[model samples]
Target chain A: MEEISFASQLLQYTITGITIGSIYAMVAIGFNVIYNVTEAINFAQGEFVMLGGLVMVLFRVTLNIPVVISFPLTIMVVTVVGVLLDRLVIRPIRKPSVLSMIIATIGAAFFIKGAAMFIWGKDPFDLPPFTGRNPINFLGAVILPQSLWVVGFLVAVVITLTLFFDRTILGKALRACAVNPNASSLVGINVQYMILVSFAMSAAIGAVGGIVITPISLMEYDRGAMLAVKGFAACVLGGMGSFYGAVMGGLIIGLIESLGAGLISSGYKDAFALLVLLFVLFLKPSGLFGSAEISKIRKF
Target chain B: MKLPAAREALPSGRTCGECAHCSSSSGIRFETGRDLPVKKSKNSLHLIGFGLGLLLLPWLAGHVELLGHYMDVMVFVGIYSILTISLCLLMGYAGQISLGHASFFGIGAYVSGVMTTRYGVNPWLCIPIGMGVCAIVAFVVGAPSLKLRGHYLAMATLAFCIIVTIVFNENVELTGGPDGLAFIPGLSVMGHPLDSIAKYYYLVWGFVLVTLLLSLNIIRSRIGRAMRSIHGSELAASTMGVNVSKYKIVVFVYSAALASVGGSLYAHYLNFLSPASFDLFVSIKLLIMIILGGMHSLWGAVVGAVLITFLNYEWLHYFEEAEGMIYGLIILVIMIFLPGGLVSIPGKVRSLWAK
Candidate 1:
C-alpha cells in the first residue's frame, strides 16, 4: 500500500514487534514458572493482567492516585488471589488426573472473566501514559518512551529472575521441587509452599506486564483472553516445560506477527505465533528449551 | 514420586473409619467390574418414546401459550444435540481437546454455501463434500499436533480456530466477510427445495436420527471400546497395542466430519452462514453440553445438548439484566457439583427411587 521506505518500515515494525513481544515474553515466563512448579497451567493467569489493568483504572483514573502506588497495590492484590487459588482450586485435585485440575482452573477463569467484565465493563479503558509523553527519533524512526519502558522492564525482570533462580535458596528449593518434589519434600523443602510462591510470583509478573503495556495496548476487561493466547502460544513455541524458552519464543512470535503483517495481511498477522506453535510442536515437540518427560496426566 | 494409594495413606494418616470416601480401610477401592455397567442407553424403546415425544410435540405446539417458540427451541435442540455428540466422541472417547472444533462446522457451512452459490452443486451432494473437506482439514491439523500434550495441544487447536475465523473475516470476496451470505436455497432433494420451516423441521429431525444412530453404533462398537481404553489409560492402551495415535486421528476426523454435516444442514435450514456462528465460544458450549450430559453415554450427549440449548434460551432469559453473568455462574456450579452431567441424574434418581 502506502509508499514507505522498506528499511524504515521494517525497523519501525520490528521495534513495535519487540515491544509487543516483551509483553508476551513476560506472560509466558509467568505461565512457565507456575507450570514448572505445579504441573498445571493457571487458566486464570490471564485474569491477573485484567486485574492489574482494572486496579490501575480504578485507582489512577477513578480515585486519581499515583501510578507508582496503583501498580504495586494491584500486583499485591493479584498475588494474594494467586495464593488463594493454589490453596483452594489446585490443592484438592493435586493427585492424578491433572486434566481435571486444569479444567477446574478453566472454570475459575470463566468465573473470574465474567466477574471482571461485570465489575469493569467490556469497554477499553483509556490508560494514562506511564512515562513522559515524548517520542525518541533514532535514524528518522520515531518511538514512544513507554516502549522503552516495556523493553527495559522486560530485560530487568528477566535478569532479576535468572539471578533469583540460580542464586537464591528459595529459587533453588523451587527448582529442586520441580525436578523431584518427593526429594525436595524429604529434604524439608515445603513443595506446597514453593508451588504457592510460584503462583504468586507469576501473578505478580503478569500484573507488571499489564502496568507496562497499558499505555500502548490500552487496558480493558476482556484483553486478558488475547494476551493469554499470545502468552500461551509463546510458551508452546519456545517449549512448554522450559522457562527460558518462553522469552525466546515470545520475541520470535512477536517478530513473526509484525513481519507477517508487513508481508501479508495485517489481519492474519495474529495467526503467525499459532502456526509456529503447530510447526515447533511437529518438529521439536518438547520445544526449544523444553526437556522431554514422559507424562502421566491425561492429555487434554 | 508416586505416593501410595489411599489404604497406604491409612498407615500414614486417617483410615476409612475417619475418611468419608473409604469404608473398612481396604483403601479407596476402585470399581474393577464391581458395579453394573450403564443399563440405560437409549434403544429402540427410546426411538419409540422420541417418536411419541415428537407426536406429542405437535399437540403441545397447538397450545395458545407455546407456538412458534417451541418449534424454534426444538430446532436448536436438534442442532446442538449433533454438536454435543461430536464433542463427546472426541473429548470423552478420543482423549483429545480440540478448541478449534468450530472451524470444521464453519468450513462445512461455507463449503455448502460456496457449492450452492457458485457451482450450483446439489445441496445434498454438497453434504458429503462438506464432511470430506472438514475431515481432511481436521486430519491435517490434528495429525501433526497430537504429539503435544494437554494445554499445548489445546492452544494449538485454539489458534487454528482463530485463524480460520480470521480467514473467513479477512477474505471478503469469498466469505462475504462480516456481512455473511444470505438467501441460501432451502435444502432440496434432487431439485425440490423445501421452503417452509415446518418441512425443514422434518428434514433436520430426520438427519438428527441418522446422527444419533451413527453415534449409538460408534459408542457400542469395537472402535468405541478402543476410544474408551485410550481415554481411561493412554499408556495401558498403548501397551495393549491399541495404536493410540491412530485411534485419536480417526476419532478426531470423524468428529470434525459430523460437525461439518451439522454445519451444512444448519446453513441450509437457517439460510445464513456467518463466521460468528461458529467460534471458540460455540466449541466451548459444545464441550459444556457433553460434560453436562455425562460423557459416558450417547444419551448423555443428547440430553446435555438439548438441556444446554434450552437453558441458553430459556433459563438465562430470566436474567435479562445479567444473562452473561447467569450463564457463567451456571457453568461454574454445574462443573463443580455435576461434572458427570444431568444425564447421570435420571439413573441416580432411579436407583435412589428403587431404594
Candidate 2:
C-alpha cells in the first residue's frame, strides 16, 4: 500500500468531518429547539430526518418528480408528522412525569421507525446527487459536490434559525417559554402553541438535514436510532440548548470520529465518539456551553 | 405551576407512626386495613399458591406435548424475569431508567463465555466473576451518571451499551466478532452438566425464584422504603438523611449484577454467546417487558418477561417483517391507553365497573 501524506490525510479527514458534522449539527439544532421550549427530548427527531430522505426518494425517484419540488414537499410532510406527534401523543397525557414523557417519545420513535419500514421496506434507498457525480479536488484533498450541498444547506438553515430566534416575535415567545413558561403565560404568550411550533420547526430542520445527506449517505429504516444518538451526543457535547455549542460539538465529534478511524482501527470508530460523550458527561454534566441550571437538581 | 405545587403538596419525610396506613415497622404500607395476623396468613396462602403454580409448570410442560415447544422459551423467561425484576427495583422503586442494561448483560455473557470456552474456568466461578465485573462497571459508570437527575442516566447508559457492543464486534479474537462465540459449555453442578431442557429449566427457575425472594425481602425492608422515598422526592429523601445518591448507585449496581447473572445463564443455556443477543434491542425489550407488565410492581416484571418471551417465540413468528411495527404499536398503545401497564388492568377495570 502506498503511503498517503499525513497533511493530505488530515485535510481529507477534515473535509469528511465537516460534511458529516453539518448533518449532526442540523439534528442537534432540532433537538435544541424543542428542548428549549418543552424540556423534552424528542427521541423521534431522527425519524423526521429519515422521513425527509425517504419521502424525497418517493417523490423524486419512484414518482418521477423533480428535486426542486420534492425537497420542499418532503420537509412539509415531516413537519406535519411532527405536529401530529405533538397533538396526538404528547398533548393527550393528562399529567405526565418526566419518565412518562420520555417513554412516550421513545414509543413515538419506534412507531415512526416501524412506519418507515412498512412504507419503504427493509432495503436502504439512495438518491442521486443534485449535481454530477464528480469529485472536486481542493488542496490535495477531494470533496464531493453533494458534500457542498450538505454544508451549504446546513449553513443556510442555521443562519435562518439564528435570525428567526433573534429577530422574530414568535421566536421571542418561544424563548420566553423556555426561560419560564409560567412567566411567558403571564405575559400572554401561548406556551402550548409555541411548543407545537418548536416541534414543527425542529422537524423541518431535521428534514432538510435528511434530504441533503441522503445523496451522500443512504437512508434506511433503522438508521434513525443511530442518527438520533449521534445528534444527541452532539447536543450533549456542545451543551444542550446552546446553538453555537451544538455546532462546535458536532464538528468536534465528527473530526474525532474521522481521525480516530484514520489513526486507530476503523472498527472502533463509533466507540471513540461514545467515549468522548461519556468523558464529557462525567467531567461536565452541563456540557461545554450548557447552563448550570441543567446540572443542578431542582429542590422541592 | 399547578403540577409543581401539587407535587410539593405531598407530605415529606413522614414516619409510619404518623401515617395510619403503615402499621409495620418497615414503613411500607399495604392499602388494606386488615389485622396483622389475617394479612400475614393471607400472604402465606398467596405464597403457597404461587409456589404450587411454579412447581406445576415444568411438570405440565413435560406431560403436555403442546407445552414442550415452549420449554426453551420458559428458560428465556426465567432469565428475562431476573433482568426485569432488577430493572423493576431500579425504575419502579428508585425511579431511575437505564437504557443500556444489555451492556451489563453482555459483559456477563462475554466474561462467562470467554472463561468457560478459552480459560477452562468452572461455570460456577465464571458466573460470580461476571457478576463482579458487572458490579464494578456499574459502580464506576453509575457513580458519575446517577449524580445527575432525570434523563442523564438513560443517555449515559445508552452510550455505555453502544461502546460495549462495538467492543464485542471489534474484538473478533475474543468474542468471535459479529459471528459470535459458539461451543460454550453448558452449566454444571458438582460433576453433572445441565444438558437437558428440563434440567436447565429447573436451574434457571431456581435462580429466578431466589432473585424474586431476595427482591421481595428488599422491598419489604427499610432499604426499600428509602428507595420509595427517593422515588417520591430525591430532595426530601436527602433531607431525611436517606443518602439518596448512595442508594441510587447501589440499586443500579445491584440491578447490573442481576442482569449479569441472567446473561451467564443465557450463555450456559444456549451454549453460545453472541453480541447480537445483548444489543440495544435487547435492552429495549427488557424495558418493554417491565413497562408492559407494570413498572410499579415486582410481579409485573415476571408477567412482562413471560408475556414478551411468548410473543417473541410464538406470536411474532407469523409476522416477522412486521415485528418492529408491532413492537412500536404496542408501546404507543400501552403508553396512550394503559400507561400503568397490564398489571394495572384489573384495578382499572374494577374502577370502571364501580363508576
Would you estimate the TM-scores of all the predictions?
A: 0.89, 0.94
RMSD vs true structure, all candidates: 6.2, 3.4
- CAPRI verdict (incorrect, acceptable, medium, high) for model 1: acceptable
B89-144 in candidate 1: lDDT tens per residue? 88865667777888898999999987888778888888999999999998898888
Candidate 1: count of backbone clashes, pairs at least 3 residues apart or interchain: 0
TM-score of the A-chain for all models: 0.92, 0.96
lDDT of 2 at B344: 83
lDDT of model 2 at position A86: 94
lDDT of 2 by residue, A24-101 (tens): 889989999998898888888889889889998999899989988888888899999999989988888776777777
CA displacement after TM-score superposition, residue B344 of candidate 1 (Å): 2.5
The lDDT leader among the candidates is: 2
Q: Number of clashing residue pairs in every model?
A: 0, 0
User: What's the DockQ for every one of the candidates?
Assistant: 0.38, 0.59
